[model samples]
Target: DSMGDEHVWELLLPLPTTASTSMALSLLTFRLLLTSSSSSSSSEGYWSTDEFLPENRRRLRDRREKLERTLTESGIPYLPSDSGLFVWMDLREFLPPPPSPDESSSASSSAETESRESMERRERSLYLSLLNEHGLLFTPGLSMKNELPGFFRCVYSAASDGEFELGLERIGRCADAMRRSKEET
Candidate 1:
């Protein structure tokens, strides 16, 4: 509104928030009705949540399993999750080792700070490289306020089976490239 775009403001300012809320509420209500109906045998017209829920659960489980296998094949260690859409994979091994302090620089605090900065930089670089080169994106642990860097959250529930598999392959290839580059150095 402060941008002097009077036409845009005129179009947007008069819209009520209740419209969106009502739409969302009605959709939720519809789903609830269908679910309640499906739970009983008498509702012949309603969609079955029983079938949908189990199938969806199975599909997500399969995806998670496949993702774990891919990460394992890529030699990336991940935290085991009992129930979630994402896996937290540790990439700390890909980070450069912290610098060794000399006798003149015996301060542990400064060394620790430098090590953290280095880890953050390496994680950001790897995140960008994966996105740019392999068309893969992950939630960086830094933004997630993780105490340690190099831990990325990879979601498994957002894509089609083929796309998800392809994404996993891309991640594997990116890991392979990083590993090969490290070996060369």
Candidate 2:
């Protein structure tokens, strides 16, 4: 609050102490250690250059590419991200059309006679159907802050390599099943 826009004195915290400084330093050190060596104990493991460089970027890129391939092969659509622990897929095509953006518009009124309750039901059911039928747990895009509907986020790096592969397999199967069902309807 030193240069505060709100109440300067009211928002200010007490001046930092030596103890606080030491604690902050310790936390910083701990974070650096964790990020650099999450759980890889290969030979010559004394702060290798690969631990903090192009190697890590390359690996993340490879994983993303593999995930995109699996999604594509299963007839799922995705908007690929450059570098992240999670992948975002566009599941809109598999889902029924969303309620119109402008509720007051005549076009929206013509689109469906569904009430607000039905709209809520459809949104909730769509979220539940993917979870219950596919045995997958994803944070529905609409459920996340500022993340629009018609998307889902999957974190491939959260599990072991084998488990990640199995999860990908299940996702592919789910996508294929959804596509076939959509086509049949």
lDDT of 1 by residue, 108-166 (tens): 63544655566677788878877887798788888777888788888776665577879
Query: lDDT for model 1, on a 0 to 1 scale?
Result: 0.67
The 10-residue segment of model 2 with minimum total lDDT is: 8-17
Clashes of 2: 0
Top lDDT prediction, candidate number: 1
Q: Give the per-residue lDDT digits (tens) of candidate 2, residues 42-100.
A: 23342334443454466557777888889888877787788765677777676666566
TM-score against native, each model:
0.68, 0.60
Q: Extract clashing residue pairs from model 2.
A: none
Clashes of 1: 0
Model 1: lowest-lDDT 10 consecutive positions: 11-20
